[model samples]
Target chain A: MKYKDYYKILGVEKSASADDIKKAYRKLAHKYHPDVSKEADAEAQFKEVGEAYETLKNPEKRAAYDQLGSFQPGQDFRPPPDWGGQFGAGQHFSEDADFSDFLHGLMGGRFSQKHGGATMPIPGEDFEVAARITLEQAASGSEIEIKLSVHEPDAQGFPRRVPCSIKARIAKGATQGQRLRVPGKGGKGLNGGRDGDLYLKIELAPHRLYRVQDHDLYVDLPLAPWEAVLGATVEVPTLSGRVRLKVPPGTQAGQQLRLAHRGLPKPHKGEGDLYAIAQIVVPAKVSERESALYQQLAEGSDFKPRSHFDLEVADEH
Target chain B: MNIEISEAVWLDRAGVISMSELAQLSGLSEAILLQLIEYEVLPPAASAAGGPTFTGDCLVTARMACRLQSDFELDAAGLALVLSLLDRIRGLEAEVRGLQAQAPRRPHKA
Candidate 1:
């Protein structure tokens, strides 16, 4: 594991007070929070800062950590003598961070268990936020704004809305219900606790052309009776917009035509499929001539919508 | 590499869920979550000390199960299959995100 410099992470002096450490953490936290930052390592660095703040903000932990002497960035390190004695010697340390092995060895395991429910403890327990995007956004991926309530102003001020701009990545098959985590935009940690994370659950609005089911995209292609009875090339809508599709003769309603690898495309996995379901459209209000033509057709072949069921019932008897 | 380092980790994930949290999070009665478990549509959560505890995955699975039951009126088995398929699809998406992130980001032309 990489050695963490708590003081440096918190941006404070070695002799800084707990209050000073906390103040520094809050400032850095607001800046590097993944929901707000576009920096490459912002999320990972935020977690690191949060872990640092968690260790240093408490007096007992800080005192013990200080006793261990300075942590040289590239040097071999070890815990101070009698590390557990510092814990609970006075106040209960808040659950400000999820500490690391080094801290746990130095501060003890009590930090993890006792600190629970101290950070960002809300009645809802979890906050769920979703974003609705167009098909285009999902196809090309997008950077979008999702507003999250990071804080409710105290008696001293107005309630403020923390606008979080996140670069949303469209999953190869991210149809809907796909979620991404933006660290540190959630409810504020309690008693000077580390802030919870912000979740971006995606919901794609229904498209006019394609209906997505998992990795598959579905489209209903309307065909004339002749097209259904005799195969022909017809225009259809896809995620890529209009494309021509072949309609086989004697195609039935609910009969699906598969387009391999024409749907959702994954990174490593093979692409998903597009299914075109055939629907035979007959004019509800036909002209006299059209009605006469239909009448002539009706006089021709025998078709039963529920033939199988009739056979089963008669066989049972 | 997908180490579940914390509880809040599941707050964002759909299928990952805790046992007691499953019903409460989805605004569904306990009976409902239990029914999902009974039907085997929803995978039962992990247990500690003989008591049932769930992982983060259950939350999304339960929410999806509820939506399926309500929206499309699908039965338990159908909901399970659909949710499983959805989870697999999500897995594919995560893979794509990883590739995109690594896809040689270029500095714009000056």
Candidate 2:
């Protein structure tokens, strides 16, 4: 169907040595391996690199590919008329083989032969997908539905995409980035092999009021200036509900008030703690009478906030 | 569209799986899995009443080792070393994410 330049994909010359080709493939594989790589579209790049290396590593396949001559990548081109006679014919490739039609046409017969012409029990492929939930859901377990597109081989060994819908219950105390497994829920098995598993990676959606670290939750507790000065019982929001928290007299800004066992639940044992960070707020604008009262207080009070600045200046002098 | 409903199992919990189950899930043989266990790559979680058992996390690690070994032609020791390095990288990534969450956010402009 389309031409793909194996040498160009591998970043090697046509005349490059075998060792050079192998080295290039290794470097690219390490950089793009789906499990370890942080790059987007890493799985696609890895499949492309793997397909290119598969063809180039074998001398026979490489020779046949070289004889087909070069064309621009993705250019619509067909193999020569007698090409099928030189290589084995009547080999069909599935749409989801992850290999280009050109490589499949050139080497499909060898793949069949590599399997020894007998139907071997091939295990199903594992699938991984991300599942995003809320912090509240993580505290209390929730039910979720997930969809997956799996490739299943037909009677002719051509794989077709099969859409799967699974409903599962996420246990309580699930943390961010945790992986949950659904056994035998992945791609179907071939030749009586067992079905593969489905892995769901838990991702907690950002909460409007809370930030999570491990199981601990942190929330900002905004207080008025007078409320910070005098003791008050303020209502604080938690995952379960709201609770009244006592603000001691003269509570400082940025102080953390810990609410024991108010955070997310642990898997087996105790629950995590929640911290309410204090933030003192003042009125943006004041009336004339209030301003006069403030002026009187400012003159009456002897508190100097910039005392450290004068001390630092004197030390420098 | 095939709709299949099922329950999920958390790997980090105390639920343990047998060695044969691990081999079947990972697509590796029992002998090779034993060699990996000897290298401390796939450590058994505990010795259950029946026999030695592994946690569900071992299934993921074993599958990764199978793929890496086949793709790179690595030995048991080499696969173990790579797996350890990958674990370190994952730990660092989680730590970074935690720090980013704790960092104070800048005020939004109106």
Candidate 3:
């Protein structure tokens, strides 16, 4: 196994006091905490720091580790033959099996047990991964196949990921960042311990025609210039199916028309409402006859555009 | 490599874990768990004859509490206070996410 330099991991000297070690560990723990840190490898770094602290915090373990003398980190080295026997004199170390194989070899079997001759029970570490799904899948519950990296022990008891896939059921209306738990699918257990859980955080993919707001769904309902001026029946697409919507007379752009109980499904309550937003569009190129008709209508109409702007200018003057 | 799919139980969604199961899963001793319960660090989902029954979330809390207590040597009351604050922080974060999701979307560029 590769040798680990606990002092370097903790940023402490070999002659550093336990109090100094504790302070250094505290600083690193806060800096690399998974919940608060933004660093890319914060979780891994935090585990390494924890492992280093676990060994150095105890005087017996520290003394025993110091006896091996200085060796570069990642250098292949083996512990003394009777190194594991020394664990009987050290403090009880109850932690997850996140330490490196070097530390494991140093402590040996004695560190793997607890109490009066009973094996220590250390549950596996939990794993979390984000899974992206489409809006249709969110609207109608679907089964999704996802990959998870599960840890398994080698012949020497070192942890390594064995890529595995499982079909997960995503319930309808699964919100963004909602956790779907699949228990006993995490890192491997130690000493015949139970496995940890796997949590899948839901991420909804962006839709071309729809935007989600909680359970409410929003879609831009495009209309022609003439249609916006005069009311017309329009077909709107919803999650379930297409439905005819009545466009009120003098419908303005950027207006939202609500369709009740047509949005995403709720686990406990009725479905939310869907809003169809109005968007007016004009043809880019017009024929000569169409241009002439538009010119005639513009000349005949007495509608003054931005009349309120004139009033505002008068008020300012 | 030979790939395999493992069966998984929904810890937070489906199962109601007993005290012993929680203790084993969280790697916490019964005595420490009792102290934590007394201090309200870990709350149970249901009460029973053996003890308070917990779900997966409680098991998570227990693990966190145990690790923090070991590292910082925090008393039961202090751990409970910290845990309560952490819970409040998590709730606020979820609330923020909900509000952001409900915000109006910008129109797509033509």
Return the top candidate by DockQ: 2
Q: What lDDT tens digits, residue by residue, belong to model 1 across residues A1-317?
A: 23467888787889887779778877886567654455888777887877777678677777776776776654554444454445533322223222264365335432233343234333322345677887667665555665453433322222223444334344444556655555555555444555555556778787766766555667666667788888899887776767778887789766888887777654335666888777777655778998898888889869777899999999999
Docking quality of model 1: it rates as incorrect
Candidate 1 structure quality by residue, lDDT tens digits, B1-110 = 22222212323323444566566555556776766677665665565664465655566566556645653445666666766776687688766753442232222122
TM-score of candidate 1 to 2 decimals: 0.44
In model 2 chain A, where is the ten-residue run with the lowest total lDDT?
Answer: A109-118
Which structure is stronger by lDDT: 1 or 3?
A: 3
**Model 1, which residues run further than 4 Å from truth?**
A1-127, A152-172, A187-195, A300-317, B1-110
lDDT of 1: 0.59
Better of 1 and 3 by TM-score: 3
Measured against the true chain A, the candidates' chain A TM-scores are: 0.51, 0.80, 0.71
lDDT of 2 by residue, A1-317 (tens): 56789999999999999999999999999889887788999888988898888888999888878877889997766666665456554445443343353355346532333233546665666888889999988999888888776655445544445677888788898888777898888777656667778888899999998888888888877787668878799999999899999999888777788999998897767898888877876667789998898889899989787999999999999
TM-score of each: 0.44, 0.82, 0.68
Cα misplacement distance, residue B39 of candidate 2 (Å): 4.7
Candidate 3: misplaced stretches above 4 Å?
A1-5, A64-99, A108-134, A137-173, A186-195, A205-317, B1-73
